[model samples]
Target: MDPQNYPSMDQYNYSNNGGNNNNSGYRNQAPQQHQQQQPQQGGGYPPQYNQGYQPQQQQQQYNPNQQYSPEQQGIGMQQRGGSGNEFLISSISSNPLAQVGFSYGQSLFNDGKQYVDSNIGKYFSFSSLKSYFNVNTSYVFNKIKLIIFPFPQKTWKRRIYRVGDVDSYLPPRDDINAPDLYIPLMAFVTYYLLYGFQLGMGREFSPDKLGTAISKGIVGWLIEIGIFRLGSFFSNSYSIPIYDMIAYSGYKYVLMVITIISSILTGGYISFFVKIYLVACLGVFILKTLRVVMVSDNSANSHHDMHQQHEGSAMRNYFVFGVAMLQCVILFFFN
Candidate 1:
């Protein structure tokens, strides 16, 4: 026989049997673990080949929707710290000293009952009252802003006065030099004349009726507008360091109460219109006066700084008060 016929030693095609592994019982093990199963230092059935057993590169975990950067997180923190409720920068200076003083003063006034304390230092007690007066007076002042006559803030100037200031949220003046002096004067004149005529004619007025009546028409309109102006002027923009602002504001409120009382006496409280407002006026005046007397010039300065913040708030108040005083005089003589 030839050598070709005798060479049958390589008849099997051993290629891991193409690794068609239907049995995971052995394939589930790691390749390294499978090597441990070999016969000790001798021969064994050849180890099974597993191409899928290589170590997989470890994957990093991530949530697609939760991604964020360090810069964005820092910005979020800063925004929470910069909110404005704790910092009303427009009302007072940013200086730490000023801020401290304002806060102290605000706290001092926030507690009103401390003023009657006899055991405490009188200055502290006085400070308490001063705070009380400052706040209450500001409220009263707002209630009577319109009595500061003549140069009233032109609410509907486009339709009514035809005059506006430079920073006007309203229309400009029709004639700059005219001053619109007589509008207030004439309206007030009509008011007093009607009052006297009704009184002289012995026409008794019910307080409620008169109050209700005066609340109508151009006259009532003017009164409402005046009171409205007075109230708005007492806002955060108001600054009067020397106590002049509050003092002036209180005086105007008093005067306005007097005017409305006089008018309501003619028309509203029905039967006792005069008596009601008369009592109200005297009561408010005396109470305010007592508070004023209790406070020193220093205490009065509590609201003084706001006057300087904007010259216009107090200036306008002063000018209008002058007109009211003039109208008051006019009403006094004729009525």
Candidate 2:
């Protein structure tokens, strides 16, 4: 309390406080002076220099190299976003129906892209459909490159497989004109005979009526599908004929029918599909002749223009169905 009276106020605690205050002033001044002298290294902005222009630290760019889990693979070929053909391991699509349809399209049946090559079996297969210059498989492969035409054939093994890559992947074949004449003939015969027997046994065997209905159904279906353009949308992805799409739809029905009806019978679905298959085969042989005869018949009457795509499809279908009907007629008489 009597500090002023002490022998040396300068040596007391009061003096020590004064010296400590001076030391702090010196320590703070050094940092400010050093900062003013040193120039910030990086270009453009400076680090925390002017508040208006706070030098921003350069942000490190995003590293794609960072490991990603399976879930982080981003959008892949398997995910059905834009197109339905993608495949994902365990993802439910926003559009469930599209997802299912796309899945079915991509995986099984190779998305309807396989087995359309007319030349795989030399004379019997697709070779007869068109006249090739060389008939050599090598030349055919080059011309039929998947880029120009996308077909749905398989790898060397012919076993079903996935094709995620594009460089090597070929688009599905548009025309599958391969014909198996012998088997088709037999199949055509069996189907009609069987159909005739079934109707006859049912006590409602009217050849004329049944023939008309079946012919109309098949012809109508083909005519409708044959005329479809698929526009530019489907054109980029596939070269499939509208006829096949329509025919396949009907054919799928036929195949299903074959599978179901034939199942109970001896051959299962094979017999039914085989009949149309035979018809397809027979069409191979009879196409030229049918065209000449049928065209001439049309020309004689001049019923309608033959150049119309729909008319052509109808004509083709008519021929195809007539052959099927002929087989059925034989069954009506005999079976």
Candidate 3:
């Protein structure tokens, strides 16, 4: 309770706080002096000062408004020029003529594809004849069937008229039994080839002989066309297209080739018998085929009866028969 005996509060508080204040002041002043005395090479600086140096280096390294070296500018311009040249060359390659040519080639390829699709089939393909240069074995057999069995008949010898049936009457289109250019072309070629062989065998090969052979074939074709036109007019079946008539007439050449081959192979009385049989078969084939296609269906059943009654029809039949017989005589004479 007495002033002398009580400890002073101010003295006690100063003794406790004075040591902390002096230690803190010493820490702050010691760091500043260390920085001023230390060299910059040893990295003796504040964290803020080091950070600020990085920014200054970055500022020096990159400035958007700074001018590039002439060499760098030239390199950039050269790269741009090279890109522009490549673009121009590419644009020229895509020119109108090149594009049109590509389109034309594509169209030709498409047309060829269409032709193959339309002309190639199983029983009635262009590959049916060996003389075609590239033919299938199946085609050869079918062609033999077409030649030997011109008239369609069932197992019982009854006629069938459905399309695509192997033993049915072909309606001239979309029918396996229908005639095509393969056989006729082969026959025509065979005719000339046979004639050429004959000339070669006889030691009479000449360019003139070749010309004669070609002329003969051309004449025969023309004569067949004329005969077909006249026959078509007289028979009242002008509906048969010219090509059909040509194809029909061309069958005679196949018979002629047979006669020539037989003559060449068997040059005796046996050949004569073969020729007679061939002529008879040719006559029958012409009679039956023409009767159906060139003659009216109204008289199909009563064709013999109608021929007797109708002079014009008789004359037409006689004319067609006369043409068929002419082939027999020509086969003997030419070969």
Candidate 4:
């Protein structure tokens, strides 16, 4: 009966029944009470956690895509003040200076037109004239032969000499005399050089003299072109182009060069005689060439009626003579 039976006080305290099971139930209930108190003090539940996070996400999404209203744009423009308003006005308004300049130009153009109209015929306009300078080597050789020797038979055979020949060789058909600038250009340069040489020898080789010579050459060329244009207009045939006439006119420079060389070498009337002879031959050549080339359908009929054609032929010869006389005059004056 000793200490072995001494559990009496503990058994009375609940060790004899289900005391251990009750203690375990109290532990579980204590944790549930703590969990219930946690939610009342800002601790998030699973559903409430997403509710706060959702608003933050919405703010971030809208921030990047937001646009300023028109009212905001107006506020920005007003902030720039007068400079912005000036730029806008300048962009919309037309310039007064530009309008004045246009009116001035129109008045000047009208004045020029009036002056041109007042002196139309005397004012010889060459606005529509064109020139080509490509002469064939064979044609050039023939031209030289005709000018130097004045041999009628051989020269006539070599070039277009008759109305029928013109029909065979003129434009719409290619011929030996298909306008070339080579001989004409070479001749012009040679003439210019010879002229300078002559001036140098004459002790009149100032810059002003050289300029005068060049201007004279240019004026002479223009006058020659004008003369030919007039001839074509009056002859009633615009068959030959301005370039061909220019080529023909430039050919005279070749003779001029030769005469100058002869004058420099021989220093006598020999040069003068040669010039006279060449000028005469050139006139005859032009007469014959232009007569055939400028032929019309009525020209052949005129041949049958010589009385009717005589006046036309005479006029053509006179025009050729005038061109030849002009050449002689230029030679005398310039050389």
> What C-alpha lDDT do the candidate models reach, one value each?
0.41, 0.43, 0.65, 0.65
Flag regions of model 4 displaced more than 4 Å: 1-139, 154-179, 296-314
- Model 2 whole-model lDDT (C-alpha atoms): 0.43
* lDDT tens digits, residue span 1-335, model 2: 78667668557777889889899999999999889757664454566654565556897789988887776675674364546544343355666887989887788676343544333343233433332121344433432232122234232111123557522212223222321122223334454555666677669789796686557545744453443323212222123333223322232232233433553475645665655453443333333323433443344345545555446546455644454454333222221
Candidate 1, TM-score vs. the true structure?
0.21
Root-mean-square deviation per candidate? 22.9, 24.6, 15.5, 12.6
TM-score of each: 0.21, 0.24, 0.49, 0.50
Residue range 1-335, candidate 1, lDDT tens digits: 78877545444333234344534536666665767754332333233443334457888778788967898888976776666544656445868888899899998885654554644553233442333232233333433333333233343111233345432111112321111222333444455446545645566656655555455434533554455345435433222222322233233333433554456456555434443433344343323332322233224345767555345444444444443443333333322
TM-score ranking, best first: 4, 3, 2, 1
* lDDT per residue as tens, model 4, 199-271: 8998987888877878888887988889887976675445566666776677677777778888888867888
Over 1-335, each residue of candidate 3 has an lDDT whose tens digit, in order, gives 77898778998889879988999999999999988776454376666677545534334467688888898879988999999999988887879887788899999999997777676642234433322233445654665455555556322111356556453433333343344455666788887888789888989989898998799778978886787777667765545555556666776677777777877888798888777776666666666666555344334535456556477566667766776776656656655
Can you tell me which runs of candidate 1 are displaced by over 4 Å? 1-56, 69-252, 261-335
